[model samples]
Target: MAEVLGAVSSIVTLLDLAGKVIEYLKSASHADDDRSRLRDEISSSVAVLMMLKARLSPTSPHVTSLQTTKTLAAPGGPLEQYKSDLQTVASKIVPSVGTGRLKVTVDKLAWPFKTTEIKALIASLNRQKTLFNLALQDDHLSISLALQGSTDALGAKIDNVTNDLDNVKQGQKGMVHIANSTDWPELTVPVQTEAQALEEKRRIEEWLSPLNFWITQDDTLRRRHKDTGGWVFDALEFRTWIDSPGNMLWCPGVAGAGKTVIA
Candidate 1:
């Protein structure tokens, strides 16, 4: 149970770190090359972390849902790939910035920081990567213990652990929601404005309701087509004409030739 809680904590910590990195990326300005590469790395790390959280979830039905047939695995199937991606980003940034020199304040990095500050950011990112890897390792060990029947002695304690993990996930989700609402006002504001816009659109639609009256009903025509042998419509010439890119296909005939039904 303690191990489970610890793993959850580690995953949340990694998410928090990744969020900070993403926030920094959003606010900071850099050369196009550096900006694109850094953004890609950060986005990839966040995506992998999210998938890792889902895969590690104790309550997730998909955690143990393996198929017997050959199938494409989820992108972040092996933990090594996630770790390697993060490590690659870390290594790219760490050479220029020595470790342990930068202080990380929660959600409070001044935009457009100096070189030293950027170094600090990189150092923080590396620390997050290391911690994330360690957490994944701990989770793997926990699963091993479970598989080996070590957790059998815990019995009902397993349920408690699952409940605790769920609570933790809920708390993390709430925190993320709060962070997003606080950090990105645009998200919250647009929702209300969009609702208002939709309401206005509904009113306009109501006002235009009478316009629908001008449209003629085609149900009678449809019924006539159904009464007749519909196979005539599927004839090669008819199909060829329909498939052609020309804007109009005119079927000229005498009045009783069922032109209206075909049309």
Candidate 2:
């Protein structure tokens, strides 16, 4: 039992470190004019997180009941049942949690909640972009679909956005230069954008710059916390908190009850 408690303590320590890494990764690119810098920073963090995930993977089992019920399985939860199930899960992982699944899951996510939803969305978008690039070389993938998957108006708009990526592939075939110039604005036409705005925005948003999305979301989390009675932030309730600007330092999915979000 002593050994078990010790391991749990170690797991908690690693989680605290990982949380700091995420917070640092998210804030590393503190810039307004470029997004690629943010993406690059995030990518670095993601790499570290992946390594940590491999090192601290947790055990997550898929539990099923009433063999026939498998046909009706869906995500919109059976709330009370989910709460009860996770309570059981919490008990099972307390002392003997593995480094692969339980540890990763506990540290990286909020069970029964959409905590990592934004990260998942970003990852999915990146994967789709990669797959699209790969399809460029395939003979089977039709040009139209490969270039732009057919769908609705929003789909068409997204397809238009993909064109910039195609332009990048073409432009890369030429020469590269590390351009450095402060984005200046005239009091007259400020916010009207200029020659390098598109490229700058791309750099800041995609890979090597501080990202707008990350900053906005971090700020949002902060505002949400302030709105709640500072009680939402009692350190005693949390096992740990990273240096991040949000309430992310705690054991998220492990919380015993819902902390209401009231204005």
Per residue, candidate 2 scores C-alpha lDDT tens digits across 1-263 of: 33323333433443454344344334332232222332453344334323322322234121111211211122321112222322332333233347655443333332222325434534543443333222222111221232233325434554566576557544543322211122433222223234454665465435322224454334334434343555545655442454444665432331112221221
Going through the candidates in the order shown, the clash numbers are 0, 24
Residue 98 Cα positional deviation in candidate 2, in Å, after optimal superposition? 57
Span of ten consecutive residues with least summed lDDT in model 2: 62-71
lDDT of each: 0.45, 0.34
- In the range 42-84, model 1's lDDT, one tens digit per residue, is 6655664565466456785333112100011223322333344
Candidate 2 residue 224 C-alpha distance from true site, Å: 5.9
Best by TM-score: 1
- In order, what is each prediction's RMSD in angstroms? 28.6, 23.4
Cα error, residue 215 of model 1, in Å, equals 71
What count of clashes does model 2 give? 24
Candidate 1: residue 106 Cα off by (Å): 15
Clashing pairs in 1: none
The reply for model 1, stretches above 4 Å from the true place, is 64-263
